[model samples]
Target: MSPSLTLENIWVAGERAPRLGPLSLTLPAGQRILLAGPNGAGKSTLLAVLSGDLEGSGGTLTWPPSSAWAQRRAVLTQRNTLDHPFTAEEVVCLAGVSGATARAVLEELGAGAWAQTPYTRLSGGLARLVHLARVLAHLDQLDPTAAWGFFDEPLAHLDWRYAGAALRALSRRAAAGYGVVVAAHELNLAVPWAEHVVLLCAGRLEAEGAVGAVLTPDRLAEHWGISGHVDRRDEGAVLILEGFTEAG
Candidate 1:
């Protein structure tokens, strides 16, 4: 089947070097792709380009033509910069088709208790969950054919409980045929859910393939300068970072 989204040698212009990419990847429905890398790996930049907030200076990006770009894709960025004093429910309602759906999504994400709280007043993790609810609401309101959700560092502020809840929700959405892409750092919990993994290093795509194939000890060392063993558990794999190695 043809991909829902495609990037061909895509990259953003930089003052001294390319900001991101030369990445060529395709996203099909019901797939979860993990964008894994340390700081300055250009994960956020790539998400911006894919979500149509930023333009790439080179190459091509193609998406489904049936819906508006913003309607077809929902983005939950790292920072919650909405200065408006809207309540979490109101934010989701704006993204969702109706108030009831907004409330339902909040409840589903275990954020119902804070649905009336002002987004700015909530704790970092609570705020992130609310934003995620908004993203889910937006996509849920869209035509169910194929929608994409891009999350940048979603688990950064979330504790394990919230993180697990969010991951489970994303997994359910993927199972229901939505494309879920996350730029994440909490790998042990996420690796099992990811069908594909893209490793980035210094704004370059180091590896892109099935998670089991690409998420290896050798690749981790090469890209992250970490020497560790990958202990595969029944559910997921744990990356034990033993020490730092020189970047090859």
Candidate 2:
């Protein structure tokens, strides 16, 4: 299904070209999506295509089209920069689509205290929070009729507080009618909140859709080359990795 924003038949090559799928993706307005994949599986590449930074080999990526890139979409790549001297407030201001939105986002991120601090002085997690605020502020500023946003490893370097804050921010973005897509290596942090989950392996889109149906241990183990067990625990399920070394 072509999303209000979507990708069809996308092919790409980076340091290495992965054979991701003859993949079909869709992004309806106001959906919360989580993308999980092993290293080099083209997760970042897919995000680049979504944010218009990179082009795909085949298929179509379509959006409802809005005022501009800033108004329509925001991307927080895994390689986000923390090299600037800007204070936290300044950093937040950069991401806002509007002034009021920027202020509001800083409030949400509790970033006002660090507003005057240089970017270089902040911790890695704090830097990521600043970037997240930017995305949020911009989205809030525009409130585009049809908007989209992507977060690539927004949880990097985050402790529990920032992790919760960062994810809550992403959820707020999605709640406000933006198509929100987030990428992470840990399924545990993402599975409960994601409306849709996309799992990719070896450059191929292994599975994508409702978390309940798409994240079975059989499929996960097959794609990840590990052993694991998944069972109903409470409202969600529990994943126990067996002899498998890493947790997906």
Candidate 3:
């Protein structure tokens, strides 16, 4: 079995309440996990902790050796600011990724045409794709075994087509034994491709399990304060949100 990243009693302090955790979970390689929750639900905080950008106040996070983890993991934040005049392809190659591999990743995500365009000249969505391609290209240079990628709101500015392409690329990485943890709000689009879901609410873990069990109507209403149902089809499960709850 591929190695698992384990967290035990993880906690992060905030000004008033905990920012996240006092939570625990095991993320195994080869699994795609969707981090689902409303705003201020700690999804971004959790990703930061897992990526080693933020330290937890308490508890242990265990993974492969530091050297291996540093080399094998990649992170894409919700917002990436690049003011320089670097071209899209240049931004991707900044990670020392080969020109061929960087262009290939951009092409895969429908951003090939903009490879030579200056980063500042691209739209928000296109720039987001370039950063994503950079992350994917960086991973491409690493060993896939036990590799992991954490993405925060990756679909933020993407159109349906590009969002689908990005999700597929992440899925491909998972299939190749890389663990993918995505912080997302687009349940309908994201849940279908993910193997597991971790639902958070107000900095606490509400539920964590397979998509079918954790994303039921009751749970949706409870955690997200919304009315929704999971429509399971041959393609995969789709989350249909009707409206907000009375408390929502």
lDDT of 3: 0.87
lDDT of model number 2: 0.72
lDDT of 2 by residue, 141-165 (tens): 6554566778898887777676776
Query: In candidate 1, which residue pairs clash?
Result: none
Tens-place lDDT per residue, model 3, 107-140, is: 9998899999999999999999999999888777
Instruction: Go through the candidates in order and give each one's C-alpha lDDT.
Output: 0.80, 0.72, 0.87
Ranking by lDDT: 3, 1, 2
Q: What TM-score does structure 1 among the candidates reach?
A: 0.90
| Lowest summed lDDT window (length 10), candidate 2 | 13-22
* Preferred candidate (lDDT higher): 2 or 3: 3
Error of 3 at 39 (Å): 0.8
Candidates 1 and 3: which is better by lDDT?
Answer: 3
Clash count, predicted structure 3: 1
Model 1 ranges off by over 4 Å: 64-66, 241-248
**Best candidate according to TM-score:** 3
